[model samples]
Target chain A: MDQTSSSFVGFAGLASKNKEATKMKAKRRKKISGADLAFRICNGIFMVLFVIITLYPVLNTLAVSLNDGTDALRGGIYLFPRVFTWKNYETVLSKDNLITGAFITVARTVIGTLLALVMNAILAFIVSRKNFIFAKPVSLFWVITMYVNGGLIPTFLLFKSLGLTNSFAVYVIPGMVSAFNMLVIRTYMRGIPDSLEESAQLDGAGYTTIFLKIISPLCKPVYATVALFVAVGQWNSWFDAMLYNRMASQYTTLQYELMKLLSSVSNQSSSAEAMKNAGEGSVTPTSVRAAATIITMLPIICIYPFLQRYFVTGLTLGGVKE
Target chain B: MKTKAINMVDLKRQKVLIFWAAAITIYGIIFNYLPLAGWLMAFQNYKPVTGLLHSQFVGLAKFKLLFSDVSFLRVIRNTLAMGVINLAVTFFMAILFAILLNEMASKGGKKVVQTISYLPHFLSWIIVTGILHDALSGTGIINTLLLHFGAVTQPINFFAHEKYFWPIVAFANVWKETGWNAIIYLAAITSIDPSLYEAAAIDGAGRWAKIKHVTLPGIKPTIMILLLMNVGNVLNAGFEIQYLLGNGLVQNVSQTIDIYVLKWGISQGDYSIGTAAGIFKSVVAIVLIVICNHLAKKHGEERLF
Candidate 1:
């Protein structure tokens, strides 16, 4: 079975240089024929339509999130808000649960990404080391995890036995050493010039020093790529939160909170009434839910442009190298 | 004697590396390997109080119950139905999107569209489902547009019906994943020799002709390989979307094996039966993967080991 889809991209660039060359060769400019011109015009229009179809939901959600809750229910909210208001956002943020959930989510993303990167990088380096005595066995041990597992129940039971279930540690521990990530990091590390490390070794540098100073710096692109993948994954993930910390509301992540909020949308009116009574603002559950959805996605959307280059490079490498 | 002394120094140097390796190895064993032993619970009437050891041995009873249970059978059907729908829709949409995106004359258009498209893939399913709920609601844009255009006199309560569940799920999946999935195919297309197009152009082949002849053929291997690999995932009908979107009205159609496992194993405390369902899913998945891998190798296509 596949590991997390994002992690696959991290280590997928081992042989991308050859593929990259092919792509370069394919980039020669050419002229278009009349028929080709006609086809492209139609195709371009079709693609624009496709883009609108794809983007409309997000835009509509934004519209709904911005619209006054009562006005939103009257219908005809399209690209823009009918009765614009920030009350939806105010209601969503004003909820105490959102704050705690956001804290858990932020904490997990930072700590989980750091732990996974550092530990997986170390393991990848160790296994990629040609002269390491345990390299083959260690690689095999991790590789097997990519293909098989003992299923969810046993894994849950294992965590339960270890007293990890419902604890903050459960979020951080199981994800600490991803086999797929290790492979990706190892592949990138393998591409670095061994001479860089060998010369350092001869200069009386230890393995730790060589890894930290030489290989890690050279593999920054892959590291950044993998780090983004891990961070996005950690932020988007709710299953582990639901599974491990189901009993504890304080430990639930924001995604899980949003999931609960969305699920309970069936009883929106009652919740809306409760919120109306609890606060001065009059916000409908539907608008508040949309606001919560926007809040949940805002972090990724904000960082996406800055990190977009990494995603493109990472995905291209993942696709071509595979 | 000097070589022996050098070997000892090398061994000392590797002690730290070995120590780190040991630490990760221990983690792997506990997290991954230890679960294999828990499969024994499937063969026993496992009570959490008694645990695996003191539980009564009941060979194949849970499996028997699973086979006999009508609900489990329905869950299997729902799983297969949704899985096939997901695979078929997502597979085609991704390929078609990639092909069309590749055909665009403007590189900027392609890049911008691709960027905007895969952004949804990054959003958690929670948010996606929330958006879906709003969009598919009676007063939402979809129904509102339909009514405005006189397509229908009344709004279609989409979620209130069970028949729309699989298709809605599949559409949501395609919407979220098409761009991300297309990236692989686009990469394959990029790596296709441009000279093929140059040759076709010299032969008076049109853009469509070039696409049919050169581009499609170029990515055929990728399509075949990915399709074959996805055969193993027939059981993963997706838990999050189904669980979140599904309600009491749609329970019969929405319950997949994972949901079944959660319902029985954790929620209701029928651990043995849940474990049995889990074990069953694993065995079937392993078999499907091996068979698919073997078939890919037999056909001389790219095979994932």
Candidate 2:
């Protein structure tokens, strides 16, 4: 098993070396032929077009969301707003439900991520320890869940029986330990020199102390990556909110509220009622929905660039390093 | 006697580790294994009032009903068709994107394009679908552009067209995931030997030949492993996009097995049928995985397990 696992690590090592070599070779290239020039031009053109395709939708939404809703309906607003207004954003921000939903989203992200990280880290430490008696079985117990699950309804039923439905605990408890992430963290922890832990153990440190003092600090990269995954997952998760807190309006997350709002607004706009309600504010369903998209997406977009550096490392290590 | 004392201390130390393991064990049992136990609801004629204990054991009846139901059959067809479209388009595009991106000369340009492209992956499905909805609406930019280009006589409500839903979903998926997925393939491409490309160039091969002979072959293993793993996810036709974008008009095309389960099992209170449908999906998933793993082993490729 160790041999097989090490072989997988060999794949990543070779891949990273090749990446470095490719980058170096790109820098050392001497000349460009006509065909190569053409390919480069075409590739550049394709990438520009790809960028536009990926970016235009986002920019269009921003433009529309910033524009006056009534003006936006006249159409042809592609990249920039003709008549800029803050009313759409104002309406979205002013909504009591949305404000509360934002609070819920933030709270869930922080608390749920912390809980999951601590528990999973503790579990990962134990399973990665070579001397632990139940290490193999514990690892197998969690890993098996990755392939087989009792389906959504059974899980829902279990949550219901546990009185976890329609409560905030539903968000944090059911996701307390992720087998996949535990394995990733465990893999990372195993790479830490055994001498580090042994030295700590000689100082009268227990597993818990070594885990907190010796292991956790050294495993920062994996922790940050796992935390990002957990945070984003909790923040963006609306299905759980839809299922578990359908009746508990107070517990609604931002994404779930936005989802509900979008559907309801669309449903109403098609009817005569929404048109009648249009005079109450400058916010149309279209603009509000656009604004909601930006509002929901802004935090992720803001944080993603700084965190983007971690993604390749995290994905490579977590995915291929085993 | 001294060795025995040392052994006793080691056991005591191991006990401290066991204490931590015990907590996780209980959590695994409750969250993971307990759900497996809940699979019994599929076999029972389940009702909330009777609960699992008292529910009548009507084995396979719910599954029988599922196959007999026309809508459920349509749902299955829709799921498989969309899954295939999604798998094909995303798989091809990611590889193509990786190869194209790899061929680029400038590091700064590649980095900028990659960062911009991966933005959509982090956004929630709701946001992605919202962007899609705005882009594909009747008066949306796509129809507007199509009209300007004389492709269509009038605006097309993309979501309303049942036949277009699968392709629309596929395009949305490609738009969202292609860049992120390309990262792995790009890594695989990078791992390919530069000397192979040099050898191809020495043989008087042009850029295309070099790509065909070296780059593609280099990334073949990565593609195969990814493709095999994706085959196991054929039933995950997606829930968020379908649930969000779908209306009554496109129900036939948009309703996946998950939607069916949610509708029948929870909303409609036919727990047994819902659980049966869920079981069917899981069984298909497990079987696909096993088959793919076997095939990968035979071919000497990486098996996920």
* Residue-level lDDT tens digits of model 2 in A141-163: 88788878988899998999899
DockQ of 1: 0.49
TM-score of each: 0.91, 0.92
Q: Which ten residues in a row have the lowest lDDT in candidate 2 chain B?
A: B1-10
| Cα error, candidate 2, residue A228 (Å) | 0.8
lDDT of 2 at B224: 79
Instruction: Write down the worst ten-residue block by lDDT for model 1 chain A.
Output: A1-10
Give the lowest summed-lDDT range of ten residues in model 1 chain B.
Answer: B1-10
Native RMSD of candidate 2 (Å): 6.1
Runs of candidate 2 with Cα error greater than 4 angstroms are A1-31, A268-273, B1-7, B203-205
How far off is residue B17 in model 2, in Å? 1.7
Measured with C-alpha atoms, the lDDT of residue B304 in candidate 2 is 80
